[model samples]
Target: MEILRVKEILNEKGWRNKDLADKIGTSENSVSAIVTGKKFPKPETLVKIADVLDIDIRELFNPSKSVDLQEIFTKDENGNLKSVGFIKK
Candidate 1:
């Protein structure tokens, strides 16, 4: 993940690490680690960061390749195909 991109966004928004940490309910050190690529945040934390930045979660973890809907459904551990969302053509 290009965590520096997040830092750049914060800088552009005139926000400090502490400000972001407070907004995301995390510590400044944790935010620093994330920004420096020393750690990865949990999904919930990623969502929180995206919400605070007014960006989509996909912007943070941009998938490099197209997802195969059929593969995803076929790999379902529970074999519950109905649980899968719409398959992209």
Candidate 2:
């Protein structure tokens, strides 16, 4: 889905996962997992990714599925999106 788009963006920018991770202050593995769809980025981190890649967040939405952008990014009472089941190391 959007993983393809991310890869395309990276290629277009002559960058790689490590480059993206470095630019956004995240681990390369995190970015790799994200690109491979093995994990999802935190909503805030996703925003950073969109900014780094110079794309709209909507562009990252997977078109093949029923992606509820609002629900996925909805803030909790603590003002943080609920965990997407992975943790930052």
Candidate 3:
């Protein structure tokens, strides 16, 4: 799930990960992890990131309609692919 739009916003602002990291007093690796969704940021960190980017925190998330459930899938016992939205009764 490509939730965060940090990387895109960074590109738009002509800023690098290190630039944001320095502004927020964190390591570039930490920012990269957040940008890549490898690390879920703490609320404070998220606020700092939003502040640095001059965007509302809500802008960091993808709209619900924009999230593709098919992208989040897993295999079943029979090796059948199952989307996260699949329901079994």
Candidate 4:
């Protein structure tokens, strides 16, 4: 599955593959492979990537789901908690 958000973040930073490669001390081909998802970056490399991009490592991956923190859950009579829906904070 496509998990990494490298390409999207790179676009936001207005950076080319070469720029990232240089900053991370890797080759452009290596960066390209990571960007295309043909290869996954090692943990150390991921740290370097995050540092170069000036973002948290968690931000490098796509969020599996979007959750609204404003949604409050309460237990029903049956004792099952369920989302009542979103509410303004």
Task: Enumerate residue pairs that collide in model 4.
Answer: none
Cα lDDT for residue 1, candidate 3: 64
The lDDT, on a scale of 0 to 1, for candidate 2 is 0.78
lDDT of 4 by residue, 1-89 (tens): 67999999999999999999999999999999999999999999999999989999999998797655697898999999988888755
- lDDT per residue, candidate 1, 1-89, as tens digits? 46436677788789998999999998999999988788888889988998999987777754667776643344456765644455666
**Decreasing lDDT order of the candidates:** 4, 3, 1, 2
> Could you tell me which residue pairs clash in candidate 1?
none
**Which segments of candidate 2 are over 4 A away from where they belong?**
1-4, 65-89
As a whole number from 0 to 100, the lDDT of residue 33 in candidate 3 is 96
The clash number for model 3 is 0
Summed backbone clashes in each candidate are 0, 0, 0, 0
> Which stretches of candidate 1 lie above 4 Å from their native place?
1-4, 62-89
What does each candidate score in C-alpha RMSD? 9.4, 12.9, 12.1, 8.6
* C-alpha TM-scores of all predictions: 0.63, 0.62, 0.70, 0.75
Better of 2 and 4 by lDDT: 4
Q: Model 3, poorest ten-residue lDDT window?
A: 63-72
Model 3 C-alpha lDDT versus the unseen true structure? 0.88
In model 3, where do residues sit more than 4 Å from their true spots?
66-89
lDDT of 3 by residue, 1-89 (tens): 68889988999999999999999999999999988889989999989999989999999887767433334578999999887764333
Distance from true location, Cα of 50 in model 3, Å: 0.6
